[model samples]
Target: MWPTVSPQSRSSPSADGAAILRLEQLTRTFAVGDQFVRALDGVDLQVAAGEYISLMGPSGSGKSTLLNILGLLDRPTSGEYWLAGEQTSTMSDDRLADTRQREIGFVFQFFHLIHRMTAVENVELPMMLAGVPPAERRARAREVLQRMGLEARINHRSSQLSGGERQRVAIARAVVMQPKILLADEPTGNLDSVSGGEVIRIVEALHEEGLTLIVVTHDQALGSRAHRRLLMRDGRIVQDVSG
Candidate 1:
């Protein structure tokens, strides 16, 4: 069984009974040779704050494309993306970058920690980039790393840590900013069962604390854990189920 995490250890709930994300007639296309490939076909979605959702589909299903758009890493070829009640389509590049940094946290299958940086340093990068003072960012990094059960390894570089520890550090970095939404793409795809389970529990604990969680995965068991499940096919949301 997974250990329960105290709410006080994590960021406070930010849900205010509103939709945190909304997409209308969203479409993304890529030019392939002489043809346009539609990655997202008129997709429409509304995600309430604090909701836990899982997106599942086959390889060509546009899960990654949609995740990219939601993360603000990519823009839809057509349609509007409203985040926290603001239409992001018209935002300037700087504004979009700021919004992405402030409102979204992402965890990927591969731990993206810098090999030369210590756990704390890796966790501090985002805050540092955002012009946070050294003292404050260091304190925040240490706190989140401690919560990740990496206090002893905080000074260890990514190269010196195990896969699980590295991933934990990545997670610490992702959440240190206390983003409103956590977007995870195959978060456990690279870990062993034990480590993966630990990662899952950690994220679930964060969700319990009211951070909106959206995960994209091919694993049925993992995808089923969410309160809401979405199935995508041919760049469209074919099914949405809630229980």
Candidate 2:
């Protein structure tokens, strides 16, 4: 069962009116040359707080486009997006950026850590950008890294870590801000099975800790960990299954 998180108090809105994120007739289109491609069309979706969902699709499916819109990284072409009870369809760029920074955490197919920075420092990027005080930032970063089993690797730069280690660092950084939702785009796509499983465990642990997680992946095994799965094809969601 999902929590009754009103739009004001939760990160991801729930479906069945328990939503933390809501989309009605969501659409996204791109103009390429003289042709228009509909990446997403008439999509209606809702994600409640703390639900772990996987968005799955084939190569040309609209999974990435949907994730972008849900993460506030892109806007819909002709629909309404209600995030945390607030209408975001018409927010200014700056306002959307600020809200996104505050409410969404993102992980990608490749670990995007700064090679020059140590693990702890990398995880502190969000806090740093949010103007959190230096002392608090350091402490919070340390706490989250340590929780992610990176206490010993905290001082290691990305160049010095293994793929699994790097992914862990990225996860730490993504969750450090306690965003309402974590958007992972093919997060385990670049890792080996062992490393990939490790990364998935880290993400699942976060989801268990009450974070709403949406993973966009082509890997069915990886996507199965989520509580729900949304399957996409040809710019539409064809199926939604629950575990």
Candidate 3:
């Protein structure tokens, strides 16, 4: 049985006063050759606005699968998912895409910056895709990149930046849209200790600024820093703890 978590565990005062996300009997399965693999098994969860959570487990523990679903990158095989009081399971593809772009900010483990684009341009891509005016996109991109400490690197290509700088660029790109929820998957996995520490600090700072943060990682130190921690095993969330 999964451990109990009180609704008050959310703790943070949210502007919306409703859970940012709610999952009911969430599950994801894949057919691997002749075998059917269950990536997530009957998982249920609730995430309030401004909460910081860490999901930790060994490989194949469903952490990444959960993140993918939360980020709207993948649909659950069968279950209900609610985002900001809207039921997502029944949303059309275009609607889903629109909701994702407007509500979710994803920071991938590997910096997925376009190699040929400059840092500011990379950060502007989301706004462009969302049909924001070109002028507004450029202005917002510059503002977010500057906030991320990338003002001087704004014109640098991804290949020209250091690992830490690249990661910051990716983060800037993720938040450029001002999404309410930030889903980070192994955010510090590819960086050296110092760089990873800096990245984590920035992420935590965002949490302090009231972005609902959920992180999937194998690093114990980073995971432990979250106000709530979940441990998964074999497609199930075996433990959920909150302070």
Candidate 4:
């Protein structure tokens, strides 16, 4: 469930009256040899449960940095990040890893599949890491792959699949853990239009099912499909549109 916020808080109320994510003056800086570079600068944003958000900007605009931070793969140099109303910036590494595995699902431009593993095996990887029973993992993996329309290719290795098939497999792997939030970074970047459309349809289906979905993409058509569109420049959100 999302957390209820007081009207006094800087974060605006979500349409659903609860916020799943809130960022308070979020900042992330990095060292570049003798100089420091700011990747994210005082970003304040809020996302409601089941909201479909698209982040768009030119390269180097901190889109990936923000996504990385939101996914708990990276830490902010300063500021607070709240997930379901819990501040997480100061969490220990072990706790953060645990939180990420249980709450966040990520899909990337490149399908990061283990080349030697079959599609079902790749989908089972997350559950395996979480120590689920082998029989349960196999059943859940088969279910997800079938839902992704990869039932025929379930036993095929990544090297034997087409680009689209590889991506579907990747998506299956990401969601097999059943996370609350799905963060997709260029999910359709490598596919042709037909393949890309299929991927988008699958992703939108997930959003419709009540997963808070955030996607970073340069494709205008894809971005426009989101419920809210956020434009970023120079590490800050320049525009936010919702309809």
**Whole-model Cα lDDT of every candidate shown, in order:** 0.89, 0.86, 0.88, 0.89
On the 0 to 100 scale, the lDDT of residue 110 in model 3 is 94
Order of the predicted models by lDDT, top scorer first = 1, 4, 3, 2
How much does candidate 1 score in TM-score?
0.93
Write the residue-wise lDDT of candidate 4 on 1-243 in tens digits.
121223333233255557889999999999999999999999999988778899999999999999999999999999899998889976899989888988899999998999999999999999898999999999999988999999999999999999999999998888888787899999999999999999999988877666778999999999999989999999999999997
TM-score of each: 0.93, 0.92, 0.93, 0.94
Candidate 2 TM-score, true structure as reference: 0.92
Off by over 4 Å in 1: 1-17
* Candidate 3 clashes between residue pairs 3 or more apart in a chain or in different chains: none
Off by over 4 Å in 3: 1-17
TM-score of model 3 (CA atoms): 0.93
Give residue 57's lDDT in candidate 2 (0 to 100). 86
Look at candidate 1 and give me any clashing residue pairs. Answer: none
- What's every prediction's RMSD, in angstroms? 4.1, 3.5, 5.6, 4.5
Candidate 1 global Cα RMSD: 4.1
Off by over 4 Å in 2: 1-14
Error of 4 at 59 (Å): 0.2
Superposed Cα deviation of residue 188, candidate 1 (Å): 0.4
**Greater-TM-score candidate between 2 and 3:** 3
